[model samples]
Target chain A: MTVTMGKALTAALRDAMREDDTVLMFGEDVGPLGGVFRVTDGLAAEFGEDRCFDTPLAESGIVGLAVGMAMNGFRPVVEMQFDAFAYPAFEQIASHVAKMRNRTRGAVGLPMVIRVPYAGGIGGVEHHSDSSEAYYAHTPGLKVVTPSTVADAYSLLREAIADPDPVVFMEPKKLYWAKDEVSLPVRTEPFGRAVVRVPGSDATLLAYGPAVPVALEAASAAAAEGLSLEVVDLRTLVPFDDATVAASVRKTGRCVVVAEASGFAGVSAEIVARVQERCFHSLAAPVLRVAGWDVPFPPPVLEKYQLPGVDRVLDAVDRLQFDDAPDPRFLAVSP
Target chain B: MTTQAEHRMPAVLPGGVPPADALLPSAEPVRFLDDDGGPAPGDAHGRYERPSTELLRRAYDAMVLGRRFDAQATALTKQGRLAVYPSSRGQEAGEIGAVLALRETDWLFPTYRDTMALIARGIDPVEALTLLRGSWHCGYDPMATRTAPQCTPLATHAPHAVGVAYAARRRGEDTVALVLIGDGGTSEGDFHEALNFAAVFHVPVVFLVQNNGFAISVPVSRQTAAPSLAHKGVGYGVRGERVDGNDPLAMLAVLTDAVESARAGGGPVLVEAHTYRVEPHTNADDDGRYRDHDEVAAWKRRDPIARLEAHLRSAGELTDDDVAAAGAAAEAFAADVRKRLSEEPVGDPAELFAHVFATPTPQLREQAAWLAEELAR
Candidate 1:
């Protein structure tokens, strides 16, 4: 079947709720109004008001209630209207939902998923376009997953729902309208596994969520330049597939991480650190990153410049190509 | 205790109970149990038949163990084993009473000081101590025991309780949520928001405010002008009541009614458990700096545990030997917990990055890899 990422997600949620009596879906405008994105348009009608409903304009309340419900044996999937709007509930996510299992010595589980529409492409205002996955990924006890393809959007979401832990499921708002052929499997796949969206050998490009498309574009452009770039989509953030990433990086001897979050202390920093550690000697050049600017996501007019693009990845590749040279930038640096 | 020191007393209502014939409704608190451990006149409000002997014994034992655990935690703070400890020494009855009123399926949202409530709910005292020791985040699974994490930020969990109640009611589940906060917490926006939400939605949640007369160094006088925290719920259209927090029987009676009422779809209730913080706010705080010694001594005479013990002994429900045995057992249990706590390995710093997400982002994986290498070096 061919479907947009948004439709796929809605179908995935509907199907999951249909399969599990305990499954519930709730968020702002998710009921009679559907969602702002219309991803949850018919859920309330299909599941009844009891299973699918709208919550008060309190993000914390939505998440906290989900935690309580999950504790009580309900599978709650909450939707944050926007990425930035999720900050109010971040405390609940970090202090309660994430740490509940470990804090209780595995006596309790937070089998809930929080769906957030994130990232910019449609020129959303400051609050709408922000990418906050790094913040969630930074906190322990949460599973941060983002899907780049229609199939991944459907399958990984079900996997998130089935996992007996809190999962932050981020859907790229910009990619919601992007359509692709999807095979809706009867069952969901396991989480924490990375997918090689494109295979190559000269260099590796690590990306996830919205950036996967950007990395694919970058890979296509790099291919024309005779650079065989391996594009790796990190399906899940918390229990990242280090083996997959390390294997790719080790083979290529060069890697470039891409993300829409701010460059400083972002997911890119973590990827760079890991690559440097595991494949330090294998590095043809320092692991490079193509990410958003350190400044806050700029106004829509400037966001295009702030967010990483195909040109940025190719630029990073250009830097890696000069690894044999003492690179003027490091001339005075001690080994 | 000092024969009512004859200094000009705050205007006392002529009758034993404040006269209802005031020009305006008097804000004087209502109490079912008196300071002398006797039921007051017109105390027919929500008295319960005495719980089974087994339940009473369990409650008493749990209170003793909770107190012991609190004391051991305080000592551990002094011994440099814990970062800090909040003592629930004199306020055990109110906490235990409320817990006893709850069904196993009901939920509890407790604050940092409600260790007694956690113990009454069958949570291992040592597990809570682990959080205080900074070895873990929250000590127990809120789902397994129908309790939320002990919220340190004042009043934050109140809304959570309301939300849970709303969810339960929406699902047609006859469950109730009891959220415990302090008098100081009543001042937080979350408290008012929670009360308003609970009332509007007719959610089955009880806002149990343990009015201990202070928020850290700030006295109750400075916290609010309302005669009682319970009155705050009135504006939100929720039933509000004040109970003798020191009287375990009285608290149990009121809480049972409140819990049952909520389960019956009677909407939210606001319960003000008027008590005192007999110890410093925490091991790191010094109450002497803000409160006088005399005031502390005065409140000590009205201690909740002591009052409950008086009632129990006078009623022939418990003997001195029983109390002594419970104390000895609690002390031994505390010692064992301390030993176990000491032997438990410290958490690995690398694990700090482990649970943030179910799967690590390529970026986080890199950071963890770097941290791993740094640790190795």
Candidate 2:
């Protein structure tokens, strides 16, 4: 049966809460209101208010209380409501949630997941739409994971909740309605492993979360133009799958990283640096980044110009600076 | 149509507690002892029972030792043995009283200046001083000691205590979490948030705000215009009370009442102990620049240790031999601490890679290997 990403995430929460009585789901408007996005719809009714409850509209308090709850043996799964709204809780996430286990020398490990509806596409106004993954991915102790597909949305969230350390689960707000044919209890490969969605030898597109679909669209567009591009969806960003990423880069010999967050000093920048350092000797050109402009997110109507699209990915693909290789697939297409 | 009673909104706080206004702190700070260590003029504090004679004796011993440890820690900073030490010299009565109010199963979430409380809780002095010694973030196992690491970020630990207490109650455990906050911490957003969450959830937790009159150099006057830090609790529906911090009798009685009420499922309580930070914020700080010496001298006259000793001796609960014994034991503890701290700490570079996560990431493993190779040369 077909399932939307939003439904898959709700199913994941339900299954986790059922599988382990210790798993709790809580956040603002998550209970009776079922969340503004309705991602937690029917959860409180099914799981009861004790298992899934609503909290006051205080972001820091929600996360800070989760930290305490995690330390006391509850596998707390909290929601940040929106991307930029999570800034108030950033101190708690970075200082306490991320450092508890390390600072305590393994005496305390917070088995918690902070679900943030992130990235842009759905014409969300200021503070509602943002790609704040960089803030969490940069924190060492946090496991930053984002899902671009329905199956991944379920599997990754379940695994994240089951993991001992805290995880920042960035649920792409745009992909919440993206539907796919998948059954329940769908277990994907464990975290820290990247998947090669589309195979090609010309160049590779490394993306995660919301950028995965754009990369795939760009790959399809490239294929239609007689150029083959490989798409590698990075499931987890922190324990970055060096083997999978480098192996793909070694095969393709060119790379373009796509992300919705601004490029400068962001996750895209880190990816480009890591790829070039690991695959420098096998490169056809410097790894390019196709990302949002290095500025605050523009108004909803103008966001399209700021967000990376197929054209932008193809533009970077044409700049690979590949040599005059014998195979037409390896040649950089002219604009 | 639904009936009016059915449509009425639920209470902001849980049931079984007194009305919100009744939970407000008294107009004047509550005191059981006068400045001279005798009973107060009226019986305003009579409602709260004084601690038992045995408990009072134990509190006296702990305070004497805690103050000695606090002084020794400060001296260690001057001698280059510690990175820094925030002295709790004059607040021993409240610190010791807070520790004594908790059972072994209860948790104590302390701030950086609560090293004396940690010592009073029977934590090894060296282990409790590890953060100040530049050895580690925290030296002891938090689970074993039921004490969280001394938090440096003010008021941040308040929510954790609430969370722990909430979880404990859910598991049918009678565990209460007592969080220690400074007067300045009451101004932090987390402080208010924690109180609101605790009251809403009806968690078993106690917030003991030691109104030490200073957050570093700024006075409490600059922090908040609230009637009192304890009074700040009423806005969140948590019962707020005040105590004379220097009077060990009052501190013990108030904290005990608050802790027991919460443990009995009466929900969280906030106790504001009016005290003073007699020493500088830290050994490195110059208190003279912030306040006059006369102010410090005036507070010194109300020293918690002297008042407690006088109260205990007059009641005949403590003899001269007991006072001398307490002093001698504290001296020995300080001497042992000095001797042990003279030795430099040995650090293992490998430990840097440990405990960041339950399982170190592949990237961390690679970085650890690189460091190992670099150190091999």
Candidate 3:
């Protein structure tokens, strides 16, 4: 059946809650309001307030409480509401949620999921649009995963909540409304594995979350111009599927890491560094990155320029230094 | 030019709002022991029942041992056996009293200075010092002991305690969590949030604020302008109380009431124990730089261990031989800790990658292998 990414996430929450009585869902406006994006719609009505509820609007308190609940054998699924708003809970996520299991020598494991609606493209005023995955990915103990497809949204979230560790589940806000036809309980590739969305023999366009769709669009657009672009979706960011990514990059002989977050010391930068180290001898040219500019998420009107789009990705692909390349598709679509 | 009728409005809140006096702490710190460990003046002893003689004697013994443990840990820092030690020398009453008030099935969320309480909870002295010894973040099994890792970041563990208590209530477990924080932690947002969450959810948790007068060099006055740290709870709809932190009887009675009240489904309670820090925040700090030496000397006279010993003897709950036995036991424990900590910790280099996640990511595995190769070379 066709389902939006938001609906798929709600179904995942419902299924997980139905399966495990210890699983709880709570966050700002997540109960009766069904969350701002409606990702948690119908959950509070279906499940009692005991299983799903709203909390006082304190981010640190929300995450900190999850740490304690997890310690006491409860699986808490919390929401940060938006990407930028999650900064207030960074200390809790970084110092407590991520380090609890390690600090306790595996005696205490916080099996919790901090769902963050991330990325910019919906013309959100300011704080609503941001790519904050890099912050979570940089932390060692956290498992960071973002779903670009509706089916993965249902599967990855379930797997994340089931895993005996803390996971920072980044939901691309722009793709929440994206639709796809998939069955319920669609168990896709497990986390830490990248999937080749559109295979090609030319350069690889590696992306995750919102960038995956952009990379796919770029690949299709490049195809019309005689350039064969392979699209790879990095399902999980932390356990980065190096083997899968390196294999694709080696076959393609070139790579372009794409992400909505800023390139300066961002997840894209890490991906580029890892790909080069793994496939250095096979690389035909230096691995490039198509990422958001190193600036605060811009105003709504100017977000189109700040966020990585199909043309920016093609621009990076154009720089791959192929032996006999067609006229630059980047120049044709360059703004 | 507003009229009285215009000024009046219908109340939006639900009925059964608790009286402010019921939630607010006592006007003055409660005490059952005077300067010489005799019955306190006025109605102080009438307000709360003194703990049983048996419990008081147990507290005295634990305090004696706890004080010695604190001293040994501080000395370990000087000997390079521990990286640093936050001594709970003068706060033994609150540390031991708080632990004695709870059952083994209940949870204890302690701060860095609450190692004394960890010992009271029967954690091995060597394992308790592992964090300070730089062997691991926590030395003992938290799941087995029902004690959280000793949190260092101020007030960060408060919300965790609230969550644990809330979970216990939901699971129909009569488990209560006692979170130990300092006066300075009351100013933190996490502390306030924890109290608010606990009260709103009616969770079974007791926030025992060891108001040892300072968070490092910052005095209690600098930390809050509230009448008392306990008074901070009333705003969150939590019952608040104050006790003389150095008085073991007062600490035990107040904390026991708070813990039992919570376990009885009376919702969360916040008890602020008025006390002083006779030592510096940590061994690396110089107490002289923060406050006058005379202040420390004055608080030293109100020592928790000495006061408890005097009180127990006056009540005939302790004898000279019992006091000597407690000291002997403390000495033995301190000796064992000293010996255990003297040897350097031998940690597996690969352990650095363990526990980061249930399943180590490929990146972590790769990094661990690289480190292994480097160490082998």
Best by DockQ: 2
- Report the number of the highest-lDDT candidate: 2
- Model 2 lDDT vs. the true structure? 0.90
Candidate order by TM-score, decreasing, is 2, 3, 1
Q: Which of the two, 2 or 3, has more lDDT? A: 2
Candidate order by decreasing DockQ: 2, 3, 1
- Models 1 onward score TM values of 0.83, 0.96, 0.96
Docking class of 2: medium
lDDT of 2 by residue, B145-248 (tens): 99998998889999999989888888889999999999888888899999998888888899999999999999999999888888898888788998989899
Summing lDDT over every window of 10 consecutive residues in candidate 3 chain A, give the lowest-scoring window. A323-332
The lDDT for every candidate, in the order shown, is 0.79, 0.90, 0.89
State which candidate, 1 or 2, has the greater TM-score: 2
Candidate 2 local lDDT, A1-335, one digit each (tens): 99999999999999999899999999999988889999889988987788788887788899989998999899999999999999989889999999998888889999999999998999999888899999999987999999999999999999999999999999999999999999997999788999999999999999999999999999999999999999999989977999999999999999999999999899999999999989999898878888999888888999999889999899888888765434344356752
What is the C-alpha interface RMSD of model 3?
7.5
Q: What is the DockQ of each candidate?
A: 0.16, 0.55, 0.50
Candidate 3 stretches with Cα past 4 Å from truth are A323-335, B1-18
Against the true structure, candidate 3 reaches a TM-score of: 0.96
- Which of 1 and 3 is ahead in TM-score? 3
